[model samples]
Target: MPQATKSKDGCINQLKIAENHLSGNYQEKRESYDKEEQLMIYLSKGHSPNDKYESYDEILMPIGALLNNTLNYQEKNEVIKEYGLDDEEFKERMRDMCNLGEALELEARQEESKRKDVEHVRNIIDEFHCSLEKAMDILKLTEKERQEIMPYFQA
Candidate 1:
């Protein structure tokens, strides 16, 4: 729904299939699903990291023909579906959904806000710790006893 930013391995596998078909060098075997999945996480949206079907089918068709002519329309459909986009309309649907630049700015703002709050929080912790130390000095709480009661700070 949210432009499906996460990598879909099936889609990348389809890309790998395309690559093998194009190069005729099958030495570049498929990666394990987990490795593929991890790699996908690192790619920009839509660019499959390991392997990907070409963005265009005219490009894909030639490759498809080379791969034993094994154009299993159903399997392709399934991979396309997992991506939530068809070869016909994938790019259009992906458009305008994610603004990476704006997202980075927003993330920076949110982090800045969070950092400000955390600074205050750390100050409070420092204050409390200081106060606790002073109180402990007053009460002379032993180190073992202080550790046991650390959770009381949250309240």
Candidate 2:
């Protein structure tokens, strides 16, 4: 079997494992071909070969679109041909892109969390008239975080 097929199979197996952990109808039904087909077509509409995604959401949306197609036997082959890549090569490239996307998402989440933490620390200082050290200790903030939030308090 092709590596793409193997990967798809692996993904399915993992999904099955996930389903086992769920308690309800959230487990996907293999018999729901019509619903699955509709979902595939709907997802594919977001991915035109010539279009470029501009924002973070635009970039992230296509990963689901690509993944929906990538798991299908015919669609995956078509995608490989569309990219002019061999099976193994496309697989490697897809893996790299997925990793990069995941890293970017992680960084974005961490930044947002840090911003919220800084705001919370500032609130603690303002509401209680506490020292910066006290706020830092309460929030478990690091020296770097203290330096970053200090300027806002100064102004």
Candidate 3:
């Protein structure tokens, strides 16, 4: 048996294929299929050309159902129910996912602030031809901030 495609590219490709197929572009009849049919078509597209995704149906079906914007709240709940997934478990997982996203956003913002601080220090040094300490002092950076950016100057 062929291994299932677990890469991000595979998942993205499958979504696109499903979207096109359900939009009536891939079939002779448009909007003739139900939500379940749409999901099967999406899961069938997997990664490899010949990938039947025998093992991924369960894993991918819920994701497909959730991501399909055409499905309303009741439809999504129905589809999810068919997979034997618990409502409370799914809700908990969604909360976890949201927390992870917020954490990642915070980290990214902190990194951007650090980069801007370094850039400001570099600009001050170049414009005034002063030492790192003098440039940092001109910017009124705190001791902790200076220490944080010190390695960047060394690099």
Candidate 4:
């Protein structure tokens, strides 16, 4: 079975319990569940199947604890059964999820770097009071790269 379907159901089933535990739904609190679910779905879709979990109880424990604490033991067991991964399989899935997190963080870092580069160029234009062409030349940006960053600088 696809992880997304299982995770979506798991999230929908467990979110209410988590929310209830956290108490009165403030904006950030309410948004966390949606954000978490979206992240799970995004990771599930991106994860490669070949990745295996080697960490045993270390990696899986937090997941099991979250389920057990929020959803309760009986519900947690039922959910595990419904998802149908045995111990080894469940571990592998957990590892894949961890990889998804690493992948997302890497992507975010790369994007942040690109954003900084754009800001540097924008700063050159504003603080130095230079034209875009001059800024591009000063930054040593290729025409294509300059064009790509131009949309962010529109008046």
Candidate 5:
């Protein structure tokens, strides 16, 4: 952009343009600063990820450990900072939580898969327990051969 150097009837129009440009830059910087402060606040309180978190949030480890296990939200942040997780434990716990979430998803699938298989196995065990199998075998044998059947004990 070319600079406006002419004094247009004693009016400095270029200064207004320059001021607007600087003002826009300042506003952008201020907005970014405010967002950073908000993220820091949320991290200190063990908050979950924001809807519009950016690069800094990805690198930040948001883990919290409570010594007493009974502190409220505000107090938990102080204790988490006091312990100073060194980030490794923070990352580990986050991974563990992710694993648990995956396990839960598998559990949902397991229920669908094991429905008939589990029921069939249970029915077989119940039918073989103690008297049921013994009575069936006796019925299959002749009356004279029934005396040869031995009693089975329940485990």
Candidate 6:
């Protein structure tokens, strides 16, 4: 028999519990029915498990802990210490991950802003039945903005 039953609701409930714990909204202690569940609970609380991971999913626990926004630097360091990782190396890797995440978020925002600008320009062209340059001129778009949206018009 499987040690723990897998269900959508169960997974969601577990996630909610973890989120609550991270947010300081849940303070009650819960029992772990199995080793896998225990490991998950520990990971959620930034506590490292004693046993080595036996599967790919288990291996991702530390990564998840590292990426968790609610876990402070000290908590993350504790996780690294428990996992027996090199302190400096793990801290550097964590910094890289943080920088990458921030970069991706900034890129996404820029793309969205550009998309909206393109849509506005298209709307202007449709409303005025004008050329692209004329529509951009009416909108008073800067040279950089016009250049950024030019590729959308070309395609």
Candidate of highest TM-score: 6
Count backbone clashes in candidate 5: 0
lDDT by residue (tens digit), candidate 4, 11-46: 322222344456665555565565443223112332
lDDT of 1 by residue, 1-155 (tens): 11234454123232221332566546654553333322221222333323554464433322232221122344444444555456566533323222443466688996685555445544655777656546545545567555544555457
Off by over 4 Å in 3: 1-86
RMSD of each: 16.2, 15.4, 15.9, 14.1, 23.3, 15.4
lDDT of 2 by residue, 1-155 (tens): 11233223222111122223347547566564443322111233335434433443343333433564334434444545554554777666766665666677799998897789778987998999998789889988888887877776675
Q: Judged by TM-score relative to the true structure, which candidate is superior, 3 or 6? A: 6
lDDT, candidate 3, 13-34, per-residue tens: 2222333444534545546544
Q: Estimate the lDDT of model 3.
A: 0.62
Clash totals in order: 2, 0, 0, 0, 0, 0
Pairs that clash in candidate 5: none
Q: Rate the local accuracy (lDDT) of all candidates.
A: 0.43, 0.55, 0.62, 0.53, 0.39, 0.63
| Alpha-carbon TM-score of each model against the true structure | 0.23, 0.44, 0.46, 0.41, 0.24, 0.52
Q: What TM-score does prediction 6 earn?
A: 0.52
Residue 92 Cα positional deviation in candidate 6, in Å, after optimal superposition:
0.5
Query: Model 6, 1-155: lDDT tens per residue?
Result: 11223221112123222323456565655555233232232234332333344454344445645666555566656666666774787788877776676788799999998899999999999998999999899889899999999999995
lDDT of 5 by residue, 64-148 (tens): 2232222343443443444464366764664465556567778878666445333443454477663544553534544433332
Q: State in Å the error of residue 129, model 3.
A: 1.4
- Could you tell me which residue pairs clash in candidate 2? none
Candidate 5 Cα outliers beyond 4 Å, as residue runs: 1-86, 116-155
